[model samples]
Target: MIAESLIQRKPPTKESAVLRDQLLRDLQGAASVSEPVARQLLERLTPHERWALLKYAGKGLRDWLLAAYRDAELSAAPGLEAAHYPELPEFLLDRLQDWEAKNRRRLEARIKNGHARAPETLRRMMVEPIALARFIADRGVDRWETMKMSDRIAFARTRPKFAQHKLKAFITFIEGGNPFQTRRGRPPKKAKKVIKEIRQIAVLTPDELKARLQDARQRLPADQYLIYWLVAKLGLTAKVAYGLTLDKITINAKGRVVIRPAEAWFAMPKSIAPTMEKLARNADAQWPYETPTDAAAIPVFAAVISERRVGPEIFRSETTLLRSSAIHAAMHYGQLDRKTLASISGVSLKTISDMEFLVPADIHSLVSHDLVAKRNRAILGSDDE
Candidate 1:
């Protein structure tokens, strides 16, 4: 009964040696405090595990660690915490483990039902990180407050006309008001259909595309890079980009980016190939649920990083799988014909338009210049004015 209380997941390392030494000192009176027990635990569990045992089972020490070790030795990869994320509070991990175990069924169902966008919602926040909230607030961004739709669109880097349902779902999640929640909602857009075809998607200009790319390359990680790269650069939707298969993306003999037998080739950045390969290697960890061994045909952005790793069974959160600001970038920057973008991404023309943040050319041009002017002023003088 006491053994069940101190459920340490990892073994003890030098970092936890002090706790272990203290535990050993406290337990020297016990007959089971033998060298073999220490060795078995050291060889089996992690530094964290040792501390947990010391704290919990220290009073009523256990031979349970040895039995647990024997059981694990029977398995091939009994430990997958080798590739752990750093700086996560122990309490946060505890909550994650509990949630992972409890919500396994629900999570699997979500993956099945295609709930792959914005998996990082803080549904389990015990204590909000005041420092992080303060930092964003210091920059005049109050993460706690509900963001204006325009600001949300700007922040998402997508168009003003959002996929109403998807954005609404995301907003509902955010309106839960946790510090890590998105905390934004979609603003109403006038229901105007430009051409009744694909003219609804706002196209991005070349310069705007470059700027978006530069901003994205600097701000986003590999997975996010793929999302925007496909949407902003290649004109794919966030969902489409998130779910894009490697088989659907390839380079042809013509030295251009092409979707293969489905359509024509398009220009691609030189750096994309390497990133795709890296994404491939990490895909199993990120997209572990019912994933195929042959990952080449898998979704491009489906890997799970440790910070967001959800479970022993599923491995990562799919809730935050796909986020898109691409439509906004496309409409405001790429300015490609809506039909062309629709063709590239296979999203409905109307849906694309609805999700697009249609900034007029003059407004768009002015926004671009203002950013440049701000940058110049920061360098030459001051932006205080």
Candidate 2:
């Protein structure tokens, strides 16, 4: 038995060890590896892992691998082809294909609207002719119609390159109905549970606000701290705070800081209204100017403006400061309800509700009116009549 075992076993050798080490080095340097090196590496991988590696690799690495190993038997894995994603539910697939087709039609409309040619890169990608047409045909024109004319044209020119032909083929395969002619009934009113998950607002306690300010001052640079204070404390949006001119902010005779809005800044007052009021009051209390001085003498917003002459000058375009402050404020304390918070922030209520990507929080505190109305309506049922 011992003699038979010895005959069956193959001993590890120096040559095999060297080959294993070289293969690892090649894998480690996959990013910078040349096409030939990548092909050689792929040849060593098991058939199963080869496809996995190709799919998971970064775009550049994958391209290099493909260029290097194109000679390999691609047909070896018929299971991994694009056509093998399993037939989705007919209804679902039809819906998706309809959406794509409508999107394509809208793009064609934009092209007919006299938009300029697409960028060279987009043209090379074949986004202009093929993919967009299929997309419009499937998706319909609602979303595309809402976009600005210039933007619509841009979309028309660039969507074809990625998988235009493939998308067209998919649509053809599905026998999907025309997206434009498919009249959708009014969508069901969203359940409270669904809305709760999507829209949220948070209110910060005084202590929470203090902690956030402390963290901001400690963590952020000096210039950024000032901007943060203007947003988090005063409640200015980044654009408004950055657009502040020296002339807009002044200490009045009554020892109150006054912030007269600039034309550019006045157009939108969502984030700045709170901060603007707070900053004015604080400035007046902290540094009261008894008499009027030249507009240049006063500090415009918190940020420094380049020119002393100030009609509509930007203070500092440090948008990240506002974003970071808002994020920190939300994470530390919580988010506010959309409606109530929107009122406080001076943003449109509709805008708040529509924003889907925002972090979820209980918005009852922000939009108590809506909650109250909803509850009251539920209590007074239709059967009561």
Candidate 3:
């Protein structure tokens, strides 16, 4: 009754009517909205208090949108705010707007300079500012440069260190130096060491590995099956596999097939060669189809349905498959010598060591290796877990 009375008190302006139409259109685009429009009594509904006239809806709609935003903030920082402030703080909002503008400018320059994935990388980075802003709002803290070093460290410790990297990158993009870099101090004298009888990584015996591969082949579609097969056989990291070109895999003068011949000259596994060849043949037929020699330039793995329209159709998630294989290989089959593994997989020694290709013990790999481990731990148990 109050909502209706307030809405009815003022005559709906023509601008409000147009804004309402835009709201309906945006709702249609969002995919989550499913409200049916009524022609009989259509009216403009503006939110009361704190919410903007732009993108305005009724009180309920405003609450819903604010609730969703707060939910996202909480996902990043579990206890950032006791309650959503009646209005978003001006400093936070203004800083975010400035950060977004800088992103746009930098994106344009990267595009002009021919950076291959400027759009995608910049788009992903845009989320970091919002996360940082929420951290500030939570503590009622502003002016980061002036914050106590201990307090900053405490806040940084609260957020996932992996996420903080992106935040650091965004800040460095504008500020020209990283504020979040931690300084080394004396180690704690009484730091505890763990003794583990159980292995954290799933290292399968040869029989188990074979059975798992066969099961994956049976369950996954043909395209993905081929990708998984290559990853398991070659021990290639996702970056190397996902970025493979036709020239990377070929028969040498000795009639032995070479995979990643430039770096490793590693022979392709005889068992998987026939399947890889078939996938290559199919891909050769479709892209640069007329020029078979150019098939190497095309992605070996791509989407069946085209979505990007203007760009390559490579399945970015194929990288996930490759990484997963590396992770599993680390547990069971990956090389213990980091240098040898790096040569074979084109994955670095740092990555191999970080992911515990040799040891999945208590000190480091137990807590975090990559974003996946951290999130998995969150789901598996608390931060301590």
**The best candidate in terms of TM-score:** 3
For model 2, the stretches where C-alpha displacement exceeds 4 angstroms are 1-209, 219-224, 260-346, 351-385
lDDT of 3 by residue, 158-212 (tens): 7777877776655664455644367699966885669534334333445555765
For model 1, state the Cα shift of residue 325 in Å: 6.8
lDDT for predicted candidate 1 compared with the true structure: 0.43
Q: Rate the local accuracy (lDDT) of all candidates.
A: 0.43, 0.42, 0.48
Clashes of 1: 36
lDDT of 3 at 174: 41
User: Candidate 2 on 3-52: residue-level lDDT in tens?
Assistant: 23223223244533344344445576752556466556677776434534
Measured with C-alpha atoms, the lDDT of residue 210 in candidate 3 is 70
Q: lDDT (0-100) at residue 167 of candidate 3?
A: 68
List the candidates' TM-scores in order. 0.31, 0.27, 0.44
lDDT of 3 at 259: 60
- Higher-TM-score candidate of 2 and 3: 3
lDDT tens digits, residue span 1-385, model 1: 3334335333345534455445554344342577565555456545334534433342124334423433444211111112122344444344334433434445445645745323323232211222222333444654435346555444445323333333443344345523224546986778897766533433445565577578767866756665556655554544455555544555456544444211333445567755654554333233222223222334445432222232221212222211124545555554445444454445465665455535555433444655656654553345676
Report the Cα lDDT for candidate 2.
Answer: 0.42
Please list the Cα RMSD from the true structure of every candidate, rounded to 1 decimal place.
Answer: 18.6, 24.5, 18.5
